[model samples]
Target: MKIRVLIADDEQTFRETFSRVLMEEGFEVTEACDGLQAIDAIRKDPYDVVILDIQMPGADGIKVLRETMSLRPDTRVIMVTAFGTVEMAVEAIKLGASEYVMKPIIFDDVILKIQQQWRYRQLQQENTELKTQLDGQFNIDSIIGEAQSMKHVFETIYKVSGTKSNVLVTGESGTGKEMVARAIHTTSPASSSRFIAINCGAIPEGLIESELFGHLKGSFTGAHVDKKGLFQAAENGTLFLDEIGHMPLSCQVKLLRAVEEREIWPVGSTQPIEINLRLIAATNKRLLEEIKEERFREDLYYRLNVVGIHLPPLRERREDIPKLIHFFMTKYNSEMGKECVHINEDAMQVLINYEWRGNIRELQNVIERAIIFAEGDTIKVSDIGIFNAAAIKNDNDEYDLHNAMRNYERQYIIHVLDKCDGNKSLAAKSLGVGLSSLYRKIDELEINGNRKVTNLA
Candidate 1:
C-alpha cells in the first residue's frame, strides 16, 4: 500500500508544492491548512506520516506533534515549510517528529526521509498484523490446563507480552516450556519479526558458537561459505534459547555479551554486528543453583532472569487431565482417522490415578498410543496401559483414593495459594469459590497446618 500522509502547513504555496512532490513520490497525501486541520484529519482516519508547520494559527507544530504522538504513537511526523530554529527542531523531535526540514524545501532530502519513515511504518504495521493472526491461529487450547498453576503461566505471558525483557522459563522436561516461549514471542511486540529457537544442549560444543552467532567464510574448518546464525536470523524478533542450562561455559560468555550488549561478533569478523532481539530462555534446571555450583555464570543468570516463570509438572495438576485428554483426542482423532470421542470412566480413573512422570508430553504420548489401542467406541482402562499399579511401578508414586485425591488437591490449592502467597482470599477468588468454602475445604483436608500448605499460606 502507498504511504498515507497528512500534509499540514499554513502556507498555501508550500502545501501545493509539498503535495505535488509527495504525489510524484507515490504517497497518498491529504492536505491540511494548519495544525488544527491536521489533528482533525488524523482523528477521522489513519495516516502514516504527518508533516507539521512550526507556527500555525490555531495549534503550533510542537503542540500538534505531541497530541499526534500520544494519540498515534506509530505515526511518523515530519516538520516542513521553514520556521527552522534550534528550539523548534529540539521540540519537534522531543514530541516524536521523525524529521524536520527548513522552509526553502530541499524536496529531495524531505522525500528521502519520508520514504524511510514510511518503510519503517510499514514494517511495524506488518508486525502488528502478523501478531494478531498468529495469536488467533495458536489458541490457548494448544496448551492445556485451567488450574491455578496454568492460569499463573498464562498471566505471566499476558503481562510480559509487550516488552523485550529477557525471560527465563524454568520447568522440568516436557513441561511445555518451549510452547510458553513461543506464546511469549508471539504475543510480544516483536512477534512479526521472527522467533528463532535453539537447543543449546543439542549442538556440539565446538560448533555451538558458530551455530548461534554465525561465522565468516573460511573462518574455521568446514566453514566453506559465510553463514548467518540463529541470532542474525532472529534480528528484530525473539530468540528462544531452549535447554540453555546445558550451554558450555565457553559459549556462555559470548551468549552473555550478545544478550547484554545486543551485539554479536560473527566468526572471522573483526567488527561486531548489532542486533535487536528479545530473549526468552528455557531450562529444566535451577539456574541459580547452577550459578552457585559454577555450572553457569551469575551475570548471565541475572540478565536472563529479569522475568522468571516456573511451570508445574503435569501430575501436579491432574484436574487438567480431562480437558487435555479431550483436546488431544479431538486433535489426534481427526489426524489418525479415528472417531474416539470420549474416555470411559475406568480410563479417566486410570489417567487421574497415574503419576505421569513425563508431565504433559508423556500424557499426550500415552493418549496417542491408547487411542490407537482402543477398539471400542470409548477408551477403556485396558487400552490405556496405565493404571495405579503402572503409576507405582514406573514412577514410584504410591496412591489410593484418599491419598491420590489429597495429593491432587494439595498441589492445586498450593499452586494457586502460591500465586497469592497463601492468601485465602486470593486463592478463593482464583478457585471461583467462596472464601469460606476454600477455608472449610482447607480445614477438611487438614492442609492448614501442613508444611507445604502453611509455607504457601
Candidate 2:
C-alpha cells in the first residue's frame, strides 16, 4: 500500500511543490493550507506521516502538532521551519514531532525524513501488534494444566503480578518459560506497556551489550544512529531475558548495576538513562552450578532471583498429560480445521507413559503432527508415528525396550537441536543437560552428522 502523507503549510507554492514531489514518489499526499485545516484533515482521516509547517495561519505548527499527538499518538509528525525558527522546530520535536525540516526545504531531505519516519512508524505498529498478540495468546487459563505443580505456579504468579519485583523463571526447554513471563506481564499493573523478550544465547557475543543497553551514533563500527536498547524500549513494561545463563559475564556486571541503580549507560554515552521496568530472566541451566563453576555472577543471580518461579518437567506431572493432550487437540483442531479429536485408549496410554523430555512444547508438536497425518476421525497410534509399535505391542515381536527408548531420545534431542538452529550448547542447556553430557548422548545416539551442529566452539 502507498504511504499516506499529510502536508500542512500556509505557503501555497511550497506546499504544492512538496506535494508534487511526494506524489511522484508514490505517496498519497493531502495538502492543508492552515493548522486548523490540518487538524480537521487529521481528525477526518488517518495518515501515516504528517508534515506541519511551523508558521501555519489558523492554529500554528506547535498547536497543530499537539492536537495531532493528542488525537493519535502514533502518528509521525515532522515540523517545517524557516532557518531563523530552528528553535521553534526543536520545541515541536519536544512536543512529539518525529523530526524537523528547515524551510527552503530541499525536496530530497524532506522525502528522506518522511521515509524515515514512515519506517519507524511501521516498526512501532508491528511491535504494538506483537504485544497485543502475546497478551491475547497466553493467559493464566491458557497454561492448560491441573497438576499440583502448575497450580503452585499459578498461585505464585497471582502473588507476583501486582508487584514490581524482578523474576527468575527456571525450567527445562519446551516448558513454556516465556509463556509464564508473558502471563505475569499481561496481568500486571504495567499490562498496557511493552513486553520485550530477547534470547541471550541467540545474539552474538559482541553485539549483546549494545543490544541490551543501546548505543549512541558512531558508538561502534556499525552504529550509524542513536539506538534505544531493549531495556529502554521496554520502558514502563517488562523485559524477558530468555536463556539468561548464556549471557556473557562481561555484560553481567553492567546488568547488575542496571538492576541496582535502575539506570543504564549506553555503549558510548557518558550519561546514564534512568530505566523504569520489570526484569524477568529465564534459564534452564542450574545458575548456582554456573556460579560455582565461575561462569555466572553470584550477586547478579541473587538480584534476578528475587521472586523465583520454577516449572516442573512434564514427566514429574504425569497426571496432567491427558489434560494437556485434550487442550492441544482442541487447540490444533480449531487451528488446522481438523476433526481428529478422540485419542484411542492405547494411544493415550502410550503418551501418558512416555517421558516428555521436551516438556509441553514437544507434546504440542507431536499432537500437531499427528493431526496433520491422521486419516480417520479419531487420532490412532499409527498417526503418532513414534508410538505406533510400542502402543500396540505384538505377542510374537520383541519389545526391544532399550532400542525404543534410544529412538525416542534421539528424536527429542534432534528436535531441540533444530529449535536452537543447531547450537549444541544452547540445545544442551535447554535440554537441562551438561555440555559434556549432551555430547556423549549425541555420540551414544549416533546423531553425529545426520543432525547438523551450528557451532562446535
Candidate 3:
C-alpha cells in the first residue's frame, strides 16, 4: 500500500504544491484547506502522516494538533511554523507532534520526516499482528491432552493467565512444564512483547547470576560487552526459568530480591533497573525437599509458588496415551513423508501398560523412533522395539501374571501372522493350530487385518 499523507495548510499555493510533489513521489496525498477540514479528514480516514500549518483562518495548528492527539494519538503530525512562532511549534511537539518544519518548507526534509514516521507506523502494525497470531497459537488446547489431570492443569492455566501473578510449575522431567509456561504467557495481557526462556541448570554456576541479572561491560573476566539479562529481555512479556530448583543458593538470593522489588542490579553497576515482566519458574525436583536440605531458599520458594501448576507424569495419565500416540503419529507422518497411519491395539496396549519413567518426553521419543523403524502402514508390537531398562525395572513390581501371559500370546500370534503374509489359515497351519482357533485368537487379541505383511514364499 502506498503511504498516505495529509496536508492541512491555509496557504492554497503551498498546499497544492506539496500535495502534487508528494503525489509525484508515489504517496497518496490528500489536502485540507484549514484546520477544521483537517480534523474532519482525520475523523473520516486514517493517514500515515499529517501536516498542519501553525497559523490558519478557521482554526490554528495548535488547536488541530491537540484535537488530533485526543482523537488519534498514534497519527504522526508534523507542525509547519514561521520563525516568529518557532517556540509555539516546539510546544506543539511537546504536545505530541512528530516534528516541526520551519517555513518555507524544504521538500526533501519534509519527505524524509514523513517517511520515517510512516515506516515506524508500519512496523508497529506488523508487530501487533504477529503478536496476535502467536498468542492465538499458544492456547491451552495446544498441550494435547484430555485426561482429568490435564483438564485441571488447563483450568489452572486459564485462570492464572489473565493475572500478573508469578507461577511455579512442578512435575517430573518431560512433563511439559515449559509448555505450560508458554501457554500462560500467550494468554496473558503482555502477550505482545516477548517470552524469554532460560534453563537454570544449563547455565554454569559462575555465570548464572550475571545471566539472570545482566552484567556491565568488564564486570568480570571475558565480559567483552554489556548484556541485557532475562528480566529486562522479557519486558512486558514473560520470563520462563526452567529447572529452577537447580539454581544455586547464591543466585537464589539475587533472584529473590529481584522478584520482591521488581528490579534488578546488574553486576558491576550500583544503579538498579526496574523490570516489568511476568515470572514463570519450573522444576522437576521437589523444591520443598531442596529447601529442607538447605540447597534452596525458603523465601524464594514461597515467592515463586504463588500459583502452583503441577503437571502429572504420563504414566499417571495413561488414559491419554492413545490420543497422544495418534497425535504424534499424524504429526510425524506429515513431517517425515511416511504412511504409517495406524497403531495396532497390542502396541498401544503395551504403551499404556508400560511405565514412562521419563514421562511425556520419553513417550514422544519412542513414537518418533517407532516411526523411523516401522516397515508397514500400521505400527505393530514388534515395531515398538525392546523396552528400556528403566521401563522394565519400574514395571517389575506392578506386572500382573495373567496380563503378561496374554501380552506374550498376542506378540506370538502377531509374529506368526506376519510370517504367514497375514493369512490366518496359513498362520494357523504353521503354528499347529486349527484355522477356527486362529480366527478366534485374532478376534480375542483385537489385531487388525490392515497390517502390510511380507510374503514368506
Candidate 4:
C-alpha cells in the first residue's frame, strides 16, 4: 500500500506543490490549508504521516497536533517551522510530534524523514505481530491435555501465574517441564519482559556460578570481557533454571544467598547488584533424594521450592494419548506439507498401548515420522515404525488374528511396490495379480497412488 500523507499549512502554493511532489513519489497525499482544515481531514480519515506548519490561521499548529495525537496517536507528525519559531517546534515534539523540519522547506530531507518514520512504523507493526504469535503459542490452552492430572496442572498454572513466588517443577525427562514454565511466564504480569532459560546440567560444573552471577573482565581465566548473568538479563522478567539438581553444591550456596537477598555479587565485583525476577527451576531428578544424600543443599531446596508443580509422565496420563497424537499430526502436516488426516484403528491402539519411555517428546517424534512416511491420508499400523507384534494383542489376552493378517498384507504390498519403484503394473505382474486388482487392493488398503511408499524393511 502507498504511504498516506497529509500536508497542512496556511500557504496554498506550498501545500499544493508539496502534495503534488508526494503524490508523484507514489504517496497518497491530502492537502489542508490551515489548522482547522487539518483537524477536519484527520477526523475524517487516518494518515500514515502528517506535515504541519508551526504557525497557521483559524487554529495554531499546537492545537492541530493535540487533536492528531488524540484522534490517531500512531500517525507520524512532523512540524514545519521557521527560525523565529524553532522553540515552538521543540514544544511540539514534547507533545508527540515525531520530528521537526526547518523551512525554506528542503523537500528531499522531508521525504527522507517520512521514509524513516514509515520504516519505523513497519518495524513496530512486525514486532506487535510477533509478540501476538508468541503469546498465543504459549497460552495455557495450547498445551494439549484433557486428563484429570493435566487439568490439575492447568489449575495450578492459573493460580500461580499471578504471583511472584519461586516455582520448582519436578518431572521425568521429556515430560514438558519447560513448557509449563513458559506458559506461566507468558501469562504473568511480566509477560512483556524477557524469559531467560539455562540448563544447569548442560553447563560445566566449574562455570555454573559465572553463568548465573556474571563476571567482570579478568575475573577468571578466559574472562576477556564483562558479562551479564542470566538473572540480570532476565531482570523484571523470568529466569528458568532447568535440571537444577545438577547444579554443583559449591555454586548452590551463592544461589541461595542471591535468592534470599534479591542481590548478586559478580565474580570480581565488590558491590552487589540488586535484582528482581521470578525464578522457575525444573529438574527430572528427585531433589529430595539428592538432599538426603548430601548432593544438594537442604536450605536452598526449601527456598527454590516455594511452590511446587509436578508433571506426570505420558504413561501416567494414558487417556490423553489420542489428543496428543492428533495435535502432533496436525502440527507436522502443516510443517511438512502433507495431508495425513487419520490414524487407523490398529495404529491408534498400538500408539495408546505402547510404553512411551521418552514421554510426550517421543510421541511427537513418532507422529512426525509417521506423517513423513505415510502413503495415504490415513496412517495405518504399517506406517508406525516403533512397535512390535506383541503390541497388537487385544485387551482380553487374545491376539487379533484378523488385524495381524491385514497388517502383514499391507506390509507385503508395500514391499512389492518398493521393489517395483512404485510401478503398480510391474508390482501386479510380479505378484501374479491383474493391474485392476492391484488398484483395487491399493484403494482398499488406503494407499495413495500419487506417492511412493517408503520401505520400512
TM-score of each: 0.58, 0.60, 0.67, 0.82
Report the candidate with higher lDDT, 2 versus 4: 4
| Tens digit per residue, CA lDDT, model 2, 1-457 | 9999999988889889989999999999999999999999999998999998888678999999999999999999988888788998898889999888776778998788888889999999999898667667877778877888999999999999999999999999989899999999989999888889999999999998899999999989989999989999999999999999999999899999999999999999999999999999999999999999999999999999999999999988888888888888888888999877777554565678676789999899989998898765666445676643333322343477776666667656765664565689998999999999998998987875243211101
Q: lDDT at 95 for candidate 4? A: 99
Q: Candidate 2 or 3, higher TM-score?
A: 3
Using lDDT, rank the candidates from best to worst. Answer: 4, 2, 3, 1
How far residue 425's Cα lies from its native spot in candidate 3, in Å, is 7.4
RMSD to the true structure for each prediction, in A, is 14.1, 13.9, 7.0, 5.5
Q: Report the number of the highest-TM-score candidate.
A: 4
TM-score of 4: 0.82
Candidates' C-alpha lDDT: 0.80, 0.86, 0.85, 0.87
What are the clash counts of all predictions, listed in order? 2, 0, 0, 0
Per-residue lDDT of candidate 3, residues 123-172 (tens digit): 88898788766665566666888889998999999899899899999999
456 in model 2: Cα distance from truth in Å?
A: 45
Q: What TM-score does prediction 1 earn? A: 0.58
Error of 4 at 61 (Å): 3.6
Model 2 weakest 10-residue run by lDDT: 448-457
Winner of 3 and 4 under TM-score: 4
Sorted by TM-score, highest first, which candidate order results?
4, 3, 2, 1
